[model samples]
Target: MRPATVFLLSALIIGSLEAKPNIKNFFSKHFFKDVYGTIDANIKVGDAGKPLILTDLIQQDQIDEAQAAAEVKLDAFLGVKSYAGYLTVDEIYDSNLFFWFFPSQSNFEKDPVILWLQGGPGSPSEYGLFNENGPFFIKDNKLVLRNSSWTTSNSVLYIDQPAGTGFSFTNGGYAENQTKVGEDLYKAIYQFFQLFPNLQPNEFFIAGESYAGKYIPAAAYTILKKNPSDEIKINLKGLAIGNGLTDPKYQVMYADYLIQHGFIDPKSRDALKDFEKQVVESMNNEDWDQASNQIDVELNTINGLTGLSSLYNYLENYSDESDDGIGNLLSREDVRRAIHVGNTDYGDSAVYSYLSSDIPKSVAPLVAELLEHYRILIFNGQLDIMVAYPMTVDYLQNLDFVSAEEYKNAERRKWRYGSDVAGYIKSAGNLTEVLVRNAGHMVPADQPEWALDLINKFTKNNL
Candidate 1:
């Protein structure tokens, strides 16, 4: 997050066009510079027209919710039994978080409910909802139901977090660290269960990509901290992270990953050694902001030296990299009215700025703590260069957990999706990691069928 001024975890940078328009891109680092409109000189967010409670939004009248609601703006009252509202986290500052909920598309009512989060320390979870595995995708300027959306069998909830990103609003208040971020989400999610008592029994999950790697594990850890019978029981089941930035200490090994993939000369490894040394020093000193800055520079330096256009994925140039349409759709008066937000902006830079120092701090220990009781799924795209598969394995292998040796010596089994060898699965105890074949940073967007297969199996304890 020290890249607060340098880079963003939203999407990898893109230059010009490529041969095929297939890859997805996010806001440029410079994009948020101008996007910072007003920083709340004086405001009362509680009275700012944001919905306080939304138990009534999900009614017997609404149909084809969530994926259906966002697509058809007409009568866009609700999504497949969907609900959209804000949860006030800090009453003193009046900071609030926005969420969009979707019901299970399956006939069964006891299906699990998964909460999808997006990274950037500031990125909205809508990226996963609209682009990767949402119930609907925007095709040819139209909203169409996605064939393999995770929502088909399970309820999905997409949230705009940290009180400044997307539709979330704040008045001089924001999270300063991963623990605060997790606490804010925990309060909101706990309130969520209170509003929808019907979903209390359905197993729940926390899933996301990129910077969310930090947000998710921290949230799961918070779930454990708050689960001491203080409130409604969150039948918590598991977690899933794709190409996450969990342990920067282990993941900062760009030189090793590059050499293994033939992206850099082995001789250049000597020059890159300084970057690693500096990052380690920053981590040792506990100056997380400095470490984050050093890591950003290191990646940018390598990307420049190698002329790699898109660091997230090496398979394509800037192809289908855009969420502009989703932005436009959300801005429409009808869409805002449908979702219950009255002209709230998306991509607030303040959220990223607030979380600047939290980027480099490792959530790996949080993962280790949760490993004792939960089923953890950490999968990454094979072609992802940002958080490479090797980097993920590196940390998981060395993670301080009960099944360290067992997981280290565990065999990697072949996994399939209808005869197509989709990926490789490695598991020991409750921890499961997979290397999705032919996928880049966005695994669900590139190989959705397999992504669905992975989650369905993981939640069902079938993996």
Candidate 2:
């Protein structure tokens, strides 16, 4: 094998716990530029003089001083208590994941803790915070409160994962697969609980969008399998995914979906169908990169033929505007100091590199496993051609879950936000699917009230 390929393989192998330091060092030097920072295993002590942490289910001896010392005051915007900082993923060459958390507005003890992840594999959860369900958004370089933010009823946590997204960074390398990513998250979360033990007992729910469809399941499975038997178990209630790209191979049925919805003519539909056949064939042959390329080509062709606007939401026009104004705000020295991420770049290449790699396949099994222990809420914004509603339905129907048939034939009722018709929901057993109306790929950003309702219901096990 070529030197570069071997180096990547070596890095992957050494990411494991069993790998010796010397071998890890060799790969770190060859593959990753050393990150310039102090390794701070910042562990706060309790009255007993012991590290005030939970069970040793997670290996967190290498916690770095990524914790923000800045006292972030968001009372003017959110009128709620918030925390932002980084937690280093151990033994993996500068793999530090950053997190921003908001305590529940109603009652911290009474409300569930919801962990939100963003897609792109490399995408930062801060986008979800500012652009979606967080307490506030950045508008014209200032904080604007989002009244329907999920934090109204749930303690929300947003994490930038895989060591290179958003505020998170790595000098070693990015995570290559779902399993390793899960390990890093599991450990980081455990350490997060160590810092604030009070939140540990609150019921926990994991949710995300797009690529997070693959991540949420793996991370949840890791928590389930790896939690120390005698230690305090995370009160994991359920999992939710919105417009997620769970089964990429099957979810590539976007062309058929669009055609069914009358976006393309019969001839054009048939042509795209033929192209889709080729894409599926490529996937069957395990040429994932080729299959991805084929889908992109097909989708772009359809967009051209139909004159469709945004793939994220067909009902709207696409705009690359920095209207949100988060970049400028986060880059400010005062803001960084207040948030304790002093001088750290908000978004970086380490994140995108991780997303460019081959994705882990068939997370349906992990979803199935979670169903046995907790309920699963899968929803989509109907207008999202990217990871559209039909694609999510297609994958859910194919899962090997016990009540697949019941769910398939279940009645889809009209879901509501007060008197307004928000969307539709079909549920059976532990699986529930909702078709969010008039929303896009980022449902929370498009329909914040509806999105907040969804979370409140899911976290409470009401839906």
User: Clashing residue pairs, candidate 2?
Assistant: 40-64
Task: Give the Cα lDDT of each candidate.
Answer: 0.74, 0.70
> Candidate 1 at 331: error in angstroms?
0.8
Tens-digit lDDT track for model 2 on 1-463? Answer: 5444533443343233133312212222100111111112121221212111212322443223222331356444445577776676765486677787788888988789889988775666777887899888876667887889898888888888867777777786677778888888897777777766677788899999888888898889998897766265777888899887778667877557876888865656566666677767767887665554454455555555656556778888765433336665565555554555655655544654554434425678888888888788999998888788887888888988888899989998999889999999999888999999999888998998899888888887777
lDDT accuracy of residue 290 in candidate 1: 65
Give the TM-score comparing model 1 with the true structure, all chains together: 0.85
At residue 269, what lDDT does model 1 achieve?
56
Candidate 1 stretches with Cα past 4 Å from truth are 1-80, 319-322
Which stretches of model 2 miss by more than 4 angstroms? 1-71, 74-79, 228-230, 321-324, 357-360
- Candidate 2 global lDDT: 0.70
Best by TM-score: 1
